[model samples]
Target: MLGFLTARQAGVDDPLRLRRVESTRRVLSLKLNPDRDVDRIHGNGINTIDIEAVEGRYMLSGGADGVIVIYDLENFGGKQQYTCKAVSTVGSRHVHKFSVETVQWYPYDTGMFISSSFDKTMKVWDTETLKVMKVPDRLLPSALSLPLSFSLFSASCVLTFPCHKVPYGHRAEVLSVRWSPRYEHILASASADSQVKVWDVRRASCSLLTLDQHNGDKSKASSEAVNTAHNGRVNGLCFSGDGLYLLTTGTDDRMRLWNSATGENTLVNYGKVCNESRKRLQFTVSRGCSPEFVFVPCGSSVAVYALHTGQLVTMLRGHYNNVDCCEFHPDYQELYSGGKDCNILAWVPVLRASDVEEESDRCGRTALVNPAFQDAWSSDED
Candidate 1:
């Protein structure tokens, strides 16, 4: 750390390089923080959670009990232990009839947010009033598999409605949708029919590309296996920071990387990711890291994997039940995860030994650290 600082001070190293290295180290050292906690508000499992990108000081969460909560993540008070308070909530009366599938704050500000639910309704809400600002046409539940809906905030007709009946789109329910960070018009959708398609919103006549797991290798694919992203349902889809590469997870217990522009499967085998969710799975990729990391919910734990190499970095085992969603706060290099256990766990970067005082203070801090953060690997094999 001192060497990098000295090199940076001497103008011998790039400033961004030092930041990326430190960010990567922090991500690797992420552990369940005993001090930072999110106040429990949901009676049922948390389905989705998102931190606003503008300030990164507020978080939005939706739960299976049809509740939506907005948390103030900024810790203004000087304190070691802090619980993120729910500043606003939408509960009971006007709440969705079923599980709230997703909640997201408006891209530019915190004054507006949007939420969608299994009740076949999507609503736009005013942050201050906590009341519906706009309620679009309620969707008719599709007979195919799940009654999936995408919360697309836009002016286009296709964006307003779930485009299932399109001549060149997924025949089954579209389980997941994500817009590319690099391209405003580029979109990716995963469906129950075991296909992943990339679309250009302006040209809705057909998808720009349909990802193939086989990568156009006909001899290696069976008839049914040809041009499919996964053998089972593809529930998760995430793009790399640059939007040059894409990562996908499916019920087939596998995760694959793909070249976004060419639709070529990079085939970096992230072996047996253990995804059993019948709905959309929310996973995230790390930002400001040299070789990025992927944080995904695998059963009760959040699995960390190397983005390019497909190497398992660590397993964050803090949740008691199946973890449904996780959101990364890039500004602080912290992670927030929610699960069926009705808990939201904050995984924070551990303070380096040098950051502490001499011997006594280090010993005291070590003793107070949560056992859940300790590595349980056995040395017996060695």
Candidate 2:
């Protein structure tokens, strides 16, 4: 970090260097945050979580019991015992016929959110009224709304499109849905049918491209016309932070990366990515770091892998049951994961070696105390 300051002082214009240094420091510091606590709000397994892209002060979480919770992450109490409180909730009796598969805040505003579920529906909610507004069959609405991406399935859906309506579509349950990070009209979906299809929602007639295991090349295994991304259920879909590449994982115990623009399977071979998840397994990518990493929920743990090469880096093992989702907070290089155990664990970077020694030397010979941040810079958030 000191070297980054020195480089800036020398008038060097390398943002990549700064990012790499910062990312490494942040990744190394990651340890379970014990000083703070998130209120135990979910009565069932937590399925999905999303931090608002605006202020980053609030976080939204959805659970298998059809519950939606909003947590205030701000440390207003200014102490270690401070607990993140649930500012609001949308309970099970009101909406969603089944488990909420995903929950996300509007990209540009906190006034709205989008969620999907196992009930074959997706709903857009007005945060102020706690009422949902119906849009087109497309999960998001309008031209600019294209970038406001989140989750896919829901039971009581507003943006309803039946299977028979499309010319060509998957023959099984659409487990996951994601909007292209780069293209406004492009949408991606994974299914129990083991295929990944990209659709241009504007036309809504047919998918632009159907991804294949052989990268559209005709092989003895299958023909080009019949494209299958995986031999098993594809449950997870995520685009890279920069939107250049798309990453997918399946029940086949494999992970594949693809070219988003052309829908060509890059076949990066993330070997044996054990996934027994019948529903969507939410994962995320790290940004501002060269050789960025992909974080995936691997049953009882969150597995960190080198994005390009597919090498397993480390496993985050705080969860007692199968972990369903993990979200990366790039602001402070932190991670928050949810699982079937019904726990939300916060992972923040551990203090530096020198900083630890400094604190320990100051304390005494008895206990080596880990430090907590006070007056932490929440200003850079979002």
TM-score of each: 0.85, 0.84
lDDT of 2 by residue, 1-382 (tens): 4556666667773656666656744654467788877888998999999988788788889999999888988888778667888899999866588898888887889998887776766678888888888666664346334575555543212223444564366777677778877876777888877888887777735677778778645654453356888889999999998788888899999999998888887867677888999988899998766557788999899888768767665788888999999898887778889999988888887776785444334322221221121111111222
* Candidate 2 worst ten-residue window by lDDT: 370-379
Give lDDT per model, in order.
0.79, 0.76
Task: Give the C-alpha miss distance for residue 10 in model 2, angstroms.
Answer: 0.8
What is the Å distance of residue 214 in model 2 from its true position? 1.7
TM-score of 1: 0.85
Question: Poorest 10 consecutive residues of model 1 by lDDT?
Answer: 372-381
Model 2, position 167: C-alpha lDDT score: 38
Clashes of each: 0, 8
228-314: candidate 1 lDDT, tens digit per residue: 999898889889989999899999999999999999999897888999998888898989986688999999999998787787767
